[model samples]
Target: MNLKFIEKILIVMFLLTFGIIWYDFYTFSQPQLNMNPDLSYSRLLEYIKMGWVKQVDLYRNNRLAIIEASSPDLGDRSQLFRVNIPIAASQLIQKLKEYDINFDAHPIPQKNIFIKIAYNLLIPFIFITSLIYFFQSSNNIPGFPNLPGGPGAFFMNLGKSPAKLTESTDDTSFDDVKGIEEVKEEVEEIVSFLVDQDKYTLVGATIPKGVLLVGPPGTGKTLLAKAIANEAKVPFYNAAGGEFIELFVGIGASRMRDLFVQANKNSPCIVFIDEIDAIARKRGGGYGSTNDEREQTLNQLLSELDGFKENSGVILVGATNRVDILDSALLRPGRFDRIIDVPLPTRLGRSEILKLYAKKLSLDETVSLLDIADKTAGFSGAELANLLNESAILSARYKSEKITKKEINEAFERVIGGIAGLAMESGKIKTLIAYHEIGHALIGSILKNHDNVEKITLIPRGEAKGLTWFKSRGDARLFTRAQLTSRIITLYGGRAAETIIFGKPEVTTGASNDIERVTEIAYKMVTVYGMSSLGPRAFIKLNKTRQFPYPPKPMMSVKTRIKVSREVHRLLKGYEKIANRIIFENRIIIDLLVEKLLEIETLESSDFYNLLNQYIILPSK
Candidate 1:
């Protein structure tokens, strides 16, 4: 169960083994000789009558005897022999006493000092330790219980829920969380309902049975749930969805029932289940399904949520990144009525988060939170926190007392890609990558609709040989067809530059990721976004209820599919031509950017744009 308990058990076993070994040695050490049955009893009487017997040691309640006799071969030397006393041998001890023969009625010692210590001291010590372990285990100290044999034999309370009942403390409040204001506001209203239900009840409004926090991973969903509990000053019951499902059947359902019962007992409380997708996957299983336990658990959860009344005061909050795989019933009107989308933070939110993390760090006066936030466009809250921590680690590594802007930027790159290591050293491959990345940057800078070229680097990061990042000059909610085409053209710039500089035959597979992004955007534009010749209606549905479910018997005919393919192909070719033209016209600028990148390995937004402005002439739009 615990280290101390296990140590005590081992000690007890060791003492027992030692005692057994001692007893075996003691028994084996007793000197005895075998004698014929009649001769043994008759010789004992003969020796007693002849006065040759020196001493007789009687054991086994005096039924057996070790006889010490004088040996004639060695004149007066004594020898030892054993004999079993017969029923008529009752007179043997009396005859020995009448003859005045030396005799001892010593019982062979059952326990010596060691055995006595083991039995009296070690056994009692182990018993006390066992009692302590049992009581500690009964209180659930996060380990297997040492119940007699092992944990496997102790499954009496296996059906009990593993959720911990915790009362929220005032330490973690809304002020601690910096970004995602909209998410905070929504959860804050839930806290209001929890704290003062009468305010909502006057309008005949009922609090939602469950609130589902759906977002990508690392978006601080669980933090918001804790904030709600803290604000409401209610009991918080925490459990992961995986904890409900077990290998045995019906265990999951039993746990679900137990959790609800406990939550109901602690009314005016919040039950937060993180990663609910583990048990709440879509119901209908096909041929090779082995999720019977999980399905039963989900069914129980659905039943609990459906059966809840307004003033029951037990709110269920579930967080998941994979809501698409969840059962539709879980997202219906009554259960999980509020589906809050906790999207990634914006630029302002990132700035706030950076500043909040930087408050504890000794940052240099030159460090600007706004500059760091501007470069980290798509970073989540967790990534941002990790970025600051990495910056501090770098600072410590360099023996600096404070974090500088340079260290923060390096850490940012490490977080986005990976730590800088041995890249291709000024070889043909390095030059090729430099040109490829510069091509993307040049195209982005020249195209008005495209985002501003953020950073261009020849240094390898992640799976790419080189990377060219673009940042939105302004946060535009909608993208026009022109803007999408400009992005596709920019994506093609890498391949186009390779073909232009190193001949068409020498173009490598380095543009695979770029091609993938371009294809996805093109496909989405045609079928889903309705941005192509296929017309204004969406030809493909998202269908979040099921994963890769069959299409509803082809909404469009074969001709429509052909049309969509043709449109996608046309957009790709058209963008390729535009990229080729841009690269050809700005060949000097592209070459200059590549040369600079090869020298420095990385160029920030200001450096890249300044060099681009020197060679490229802009059209006054």
Candidate 2:
């Protein structure tokens, strides 16, 4: 297991091997194995005649044996001693006994001395090691054909669930996870059925066959499934959908069958398949023509789910962020009957997740969680938890005793885009970012569908060097033409800022995403929404008819395509010019905010609003 231990075994084998080899050659003339061959043949005969055969077996064969007790030696080889084979054999044996060799010895399978030495020494050792390995392997994990639990075989157990026999997932308890309360409630109800199926059955209520947890990543889909198992107090059968596959054929199907069989044996149990999309994705999406293996796997899963007895008490719970891409059969009623939607965590939910994850992390006593919460509006539960963990690690790396508000802020920034690297500037870069952000807020502040603008930051989040965030108006519904016009202007704010302050060629490519978004919006309005001078029409849709998933447009000539491209360019230019004018009017205030941004990378909407209060009357508190 340890390097030193392996070294010890190797060292023992090496020393024993060397010692045997050295003794064989160095002491071949020694009295014990080889007696005096130099002695007269007649003298050795006298000793041999008086002695009895101590071990007759080896000598009884054709092999010549030398008596070990004689004080004699094999001596050195000499070409001058032209000995006759049979004539010298009796003479040599008599001489060997005189060398004081006590025991008889054979020539040791003279076929290959090196080979014979190796064979004799290594065979027993190899046998012993193999024996130990087998016994250890056999005794290691009863019933399961697993490797020994010792460190040598540790990796053989990879991919097996580490979930212990606790009857539940207590480590992933509901309290530690927050937000998506609706999903939590839904999961808890499933757990209730598992724990008290008889109660529901007595009232003539049948438990749902399956529950599908649908959500974006980090919305606690997997965690919710664990909470169900924890609440039910039943053995949870956990396996990822991808875990079903193997290099060998039918293993995926076999694994699935085994998993279902285990769940049914447990009776009231939960089978949580994480990332079900791995196996449940539309089978024909890949393999060009078809994949019989994948199709078979899907068919096997379907049969086990739908054709099985309802009261078998094995409820399937599957989690996938890409539920829309899943097979339609999986979504049918009685199969994942209740599709529980786990939405991206709200701000309040992020706070609870932050506190829970940060509960044990060292923090400066002055860290304001509510402030952190307000700043992290759109973060998911996993993202928030990771933010705290990464901050604490960063604090430790920096040798800071406690995580600072600065660290938390920096961590949030890191999660969004990346760590603000050496992109720090000296002169007027921050000023440009500030005015750029303000242009966005200025346009958005007047819009109704867009909630009041929340924060503007030159401090980069994700790829954007600057971003203007607008709070959502309730559910954040679709936009109309007027709302979309403001949206396009807001997107073009950076270019407008550059144009207003630096003018013309000074406008950088920092607004690539903004420009792209603006282009997309303008194009969608024309081709899809038909808000442009272009008549009501739709362009792109994914369905097989490929006919817009609604209605196909009447054939358009080459002339119409060029005219539409011109209209799109005109719309983008019109928004850019209008946004530039708005920023130009407020040039002095833009200069002041940009200076502030250079000093501190972020500015909340309230602060920007206060600065603009005298010039523009923002809609009332």
Candidate 3:
């Protein structure tokens, strides 16, 4: 819950308590008379002219009003009024002596308003307190709405772990997760351990104390962890890293203690944390503020992990894509013990994921899963799943019962960052884009080392106004230096083709991404792979480098960094000049290809190869 809602509920409780206390006070103050109705004092006084029924006190402020009655029957009920009313003994005795009813009012002198406040508002204050206690006691209630989006500013623990309850409501299992056979086999080892702890224990080997599931988000890291518990028929306690921390200084540490205590009781179970980075981040990296709750939470977690013996039945499982960002202390040899790397799904894995999500879809004859897997070379398991789901939506939108290849292609475009909207393109611009794409395909055809360009389309996907897709015969792997350079030349081929044909630069800055791709290749070739004639020394890493690869120490002088940058620009310029020459000599092919693109806005790889038939003869040795 959020702070706003909590405040509202508190206000409501205060008002309710005040109302109940006031009602009780009025009830106790109702007038009662001891005289018989026929011999009433008011009636006798009326004959003598004192007629008003004034000051009928059921309660005295500090003491009971001691009326010197002719009758002697009121003493038994006297103590009851003393306890209920604000009352003193001396004041009652004085009233009887003077016969003036000088009873002390609860003497709430301006000096002692605190006492009167306690007496008058005690019931409401107690009522408000009990309500607060009731909410605190029911901390485990799940799925409570927080006031929109603050920390658990709502009631306690409501939004914390939708994980445990989702087990009953969420029917997903291991079959839904795809890829990484090695990692799945590793997780199953833990499952086998949980199934029969005695089998491993008899040999003096306690089951591995903890298993950390590490991978990129949407790669089924947490899903695989949950499936292990579901398959074992064991309980699961799931929480986010952030959920354990709160604003109260040591509240996070307290909650960690509580979580582990409860988790240990349900032994032979799995405790999974999604996004462990929030709690397990390398400490002392954050600002050195005194009230750093996340650091304290991490400290408590380290304590809990250390507290567990090898024989302890509880298993700790954590998932995070940014394994590098995690603290080395938390991932030390004995604590996390095993760090399983979950990678993106392979083609076969994608096929399986597609089939699973497509179980509810009506697939047409041409909607081949293998073809999709081949086309989607770089998609992760999650992307493929999303592709299938989007295809189903497209089929429904078009009012087709069966999902078709066309719809699947459209869905692929959406998954790939969606089509560049129509408002962003014009007819002449479309023709230019089509020809520019064709230029890349033509160059790809002539260059024996280039991967086969698959499809060239003016209909954009992602932010690009046009795209040229290429496919190699096999699975995607790290690109070789030669392959990387060839790819960059092909990227620049579009803009290069425009200049060679139109005798001017007709292409737009859509080639900005193309130039960026080219620059990286040049940088990598020179700095990382030692592919350049410049030899293998670089001032920066290609992986981290916006400038170069095989990064050198940053302690180097600024002049060295600038020189390395100059070398990168020089390398890109060399490739661009050579690529321009290649397109210049083959201007006829570029022209014909553009004519064909103007006629047809999109063309497949076969169409490209067919048009460049004359230029396709084997390159002379």
TM-score of each model, paired residue for residue: 0.76, 0.68, 0.73
Task: State the C-alpha lDDT per candidate.
Answer: 0.81, 0.67, 0.67
Task: Encode model 2's per-residue lDDT on 1-621: one tens digit a residue.
Answer: 344454467567667767766766555422243233432335435545654222211232323333333223323221111111244364444444564334444343332576476768675775565444533442354322433454434334432332222367367777855877766777777877887878898988878888888877887887887777777777777767776654555656666766676667777888888888777877676663225555666777888888668566788888887775688988898787788888877667766777787778888988988777776666788878888988898898889999997788667667766766454475566666676777777766644434577767776555677777776544333677977897898778778887777877877888888898999889777776788776787543334311233243434567877877887998988988877877787777777767666677777767877777666765642
- Model 1: per-residue Cα lDDT over 522-574, one tens digit each: 97788878887768777677655322336443356899888888998998988
Once model 3 is optimally superposed onto the true structure by TM-score, how far is the C-alpha of residue 85 displaced, in angstroms?
Answer: 39
- Please, what are the lDDT tens digits per residue for candidate 3 over residues 17-83? 6675575465444324443323332332332232122122323443332222221243323211112
Q: Provide the lDDT at 323 for model 1.
A: 86
Question: Which model scores highest in TM-score?
Answer: 1
Q: Backbone clashes per model, in order?
A: 0, 22, 17
How far residue 384's Cα lies from its native spot in candidate 2, in Å, is 2.8
The local lDDT score (0 to 100) that residue 221 gets in candidate 2 is 82
Minimum summed lDDT over a 10-residue window in model 2 is located at 76-85
Q: What is the lDDT of residue 45 in candidate 3?
A: 30
